[model samples]
Target chain A: MSPTTTEDSTSSNHGYAKTSLNTVNRYRGRGQYEYQHVYPIIDEAPILHVAFHGSPDQDDFAFPVILPMLGCTGNFEEDPNNDGRRSIYLHGYVSSRIMRLSRKNPASNNIAGAEGIPVCVSATLMDGIVLALTPNHHSCNYRSAVAFGYAQVVEDEPERLYAMELITNNLVPERWQHTRYPNKTELKSTGILRIDIHSASAKVRAGTTGEAREDLKDETMRTKVWAGVVPSRMVYGTPLPAPTNMFPGMPEYIEDWVEEWNEKAERYSAEAAGL
Target chain B: MSPTTTEDSTSSNHGYAKTSLNTVNRYRGRGQYEYQHVYPIIDEAPILHVAFHGSPDQDDFAFPVILPMLGCTGNFEEDPNNDGRRSIYLHGYVSSRIMRLSRKNPASNNIAGAEGIPVCVSATLMDGIVLALTPNHHSCNYRSAVAFGYAQVVEDEPERLYAMELITNNLVPERWQHTRYPNKTELKSTGILRIDIHSASAKVRAGTTGEAREDLKDETMRTKVWAGVVPSRMVYGTPLPAPTNMFPGMPEYIEDWVEEWNEKAERYSAEAAGL
Candidate 1:
């Protein structure tokens, strides 16, 4: 698993340089430029929001397209071209538009031979709903991260399999091994987009509601309103086996993982709310 | 609540025109263009992923910036210029970059009176984890929607209040009335961007795993692997009171809402898995 230490840093303040591109303008205290703070948000998020221009040509469409995609961050040990930083591996179909675009256009970044298309992948984790004295003061406690990079399809067989395993196991631990192995056609058809990061940032808003001084002073309003946070988390219910399944119910691996996930998610949400 | 009729339609086949801009080319069967199918996905998602170029000049950055924002869909009845279609109202701070951008730039759409900066708002609801026979076929059951629109700040006080109430209550039922009303200062400082949608579409993927025929034929592999969907949903836990809170326990309304939300969310997720 990717390291997720917020308070302790193994590396000494290593992060993206605060340029105009990666800086968080509003609520500056909540903004984090560190690798530990940002990468964890991307790895933990259930879904990633990816945005890219519809076509390789800039003039083709004025609006950028946003699609919900499944992906996770990983470092491929064998890839000599990899810059050592974790790259995002996105699970998609071979025929998807994003995959086709990435294959068509190589990135024209300052790097000597970067191969990819421009893209931004973002993820948000909602911890709790903050309710204050007034509607304006109400906010949701969240951890959000955005990474801008160049996305290219993984052509190497070993690298593609690595990404496939990384993504599958990321969703459910040991899921890659639990399932049947991919055949030749299946392996060929699966598309994995590896996003080489250029710059990124993470923003987090935690703790109880921050109310206005005027509202807090009003005794009547303070007493009348039910002010606090409602903790929220993604809960995994009982796994429903497919009709063709020979087994009667969820296997021990699946059930145990689901239980542990629900427990941790619940604990984190409540912890964020209290903070 | 916004209408959520998937199989039924209030109007006779009312939907956005099928344009190359909003088509789901990859999965044709899952694509939906109807108003009922699209708008609900935007409303139900916990947070919306909003994307727009960092600058109005466009050439400054090759990648579009993505931010997570809270919002809901509503139609303004009082506005004479209202096109009768639902518009997304985003809750943001007055000094936020998006709020400032919306105020500075007016949409250059064909409509003479249209005012706002161009934006794309997308939302995704993750229902379940679909575990297929092979890792290659592994997928998630999801409902996703994307809406392209022009977002302008709501200058009108009444319209602004409408949006505030809509957003507050959408996050929590009857939350607007329960809390202290927004004062003039609070109202003035708050930013609400109403997005007048131009084109939108929804895509949904549900049901049991659809595996390869070749994989299903292998009895040994089928029996060894456990394949199913792990249903998932956002669960609201008990109200976590802030240190400043006077109340000893959660109010009846908060308790009831949390209970109902958990039940509905759980039910829907499991149902989607079965479908």
Candidate 2:
């Protein structure tokens, strides 16, 4: 059965409501609108593709633009209303921050629209390539989440640090405490954007190749052409120390984290091929 | 030396002009606009994140939206002017086709605006995670490409088939010839979008951790904390056949492609760590 149609998945508790904009009309069976289903995919993706309107000043760019950014989902505080809404924090430099959220643009201030710069964030993890009998039926086994929201720069120093730490730890577990803390200049130069989720949904596909009934019945074609999934995932190799690194050896936390993630990624992709 | 500053890189031969709209202002040292430099990144990426403005009828949505799609860059014909211009083809279903490029949007027709649906496509490959002495200095070693374009549905059957075959082969080398041919119904059901790239650029960072002079000078902190790159890449695992697959055995082409890609992935991630 599809999780999209399941009862628990439809619960509003700590879940995003399906809006006309965020609803997944195609492949409805694979669509999900729950926080549990959506957030993990976003967190697992190393790079989040963020899309926003180009600077209004640049009329040549009628198209919206996309910037691949480092970010992850996290909540700074528990939901006061018990309805669990969270934000995605992003890491950026001062120049990129200025380019994206220029003062010249009215809506960039989040004042005109009463919301921050409109943006959409997407994350996708390709589990495998599903090779079918014919090119038309070829598909990908992937988990993708799209989040629609307004993004505003985190001006508050504490919140900014909170986001920076969260983004850092997300990349390497327990990395924040292990690394040297940021000084005043480093803190000032680093920019963080917190995107408040307005609506979100996820679509997942994990299984073997899908065959049409007609194609499956054609023994000659079936026997001639191979049909299968080439399972795949991002793998973390052994860490390579920097030239100036003076640590006695690789830290236990880093070593273990690498192994754990590699195992998990391999296991999931291989298992998903069978599912 | 940075490619962006090179004279040959600035050549207009089969390359996009460095417009203000597409310029990489933040890290000018890493930006690239050449065809050879940018197209491969998009083709190598398994998934492309596409962003475009919502339909005009959907006033409720002020934000641009992103869709994770399967696509690859290809040139259907040689450049008439000897200046390389290529298009990226995307595979989509009919249902999703109508939702994204509806009749209601004026620009969707490419008539009034003299351009089809405006779009921005991004592809990124994270080579490794750079663990620095401080959290602020932590960065990702990656190759990322951003393409700005106008998309129009491919109506010509031959062109659509060309794109389809290209996409299928891109997934697995020689896959199209080995598979069963698509029927008329199958062909009709598939939707292909050809995005004529207007401008594009790529950014690459591949190396060990970048350390601050002050942090490097502090021997105590350097001795205590680990600094390195955790090389990472998308690895293709063993192939698993479908339940209904009637192939006698795994094909040699598939096997070779898998092995070759897996080796390339592993080698690149590892070598890029110390670059």
Best candidate, lDDT-wise? 2
Model 2 share of native interface contacts: 0.87
Regions of model 2 farther than 4 Å from truth = A1-11, A97-114, B1-11, B79-81, B97-114
Residue B242, candidate 2: alpha-carbon lDDT: 91
Residue range B82-180, candidate 2, lDDT tens digits = 455567998899658433473234255332243468889999999999999998989888999999877877778888889999988887889999999
Chain A of candidate 2 compared with the true chain A, TM-score: 0.91
**In DockQ, how does model 2 score against the reference complex?**
0.64
Candidate 2 docking class: medium
Q: Could you give the interface RMSD of candidate 1 in angstroms? A: 2.6
Which residue window of length 10 is worst by lDDT in model 1 chain B? B1-10
Kindly list the interface RMSD, in angstroms, of each predicted candidate in the order they appear.
2.6, 2.1
C-alpha displacement of A184 in model 1, angstroms? 1.6
Cand. 2 Cα-lDDT: 0.82
Model 2 TM-score on a 0 to 1 scale: 0.92
Count steric clashes of candidate 1. 2
Best by TM-score: 2
lDDT of 1 by residue, B76-157 (tens): 6645532245889998999888888887776653133446876889999899999988888788898999998778888888
Q: What is the lDDT of residue B60 in candidate 2?
A: 37
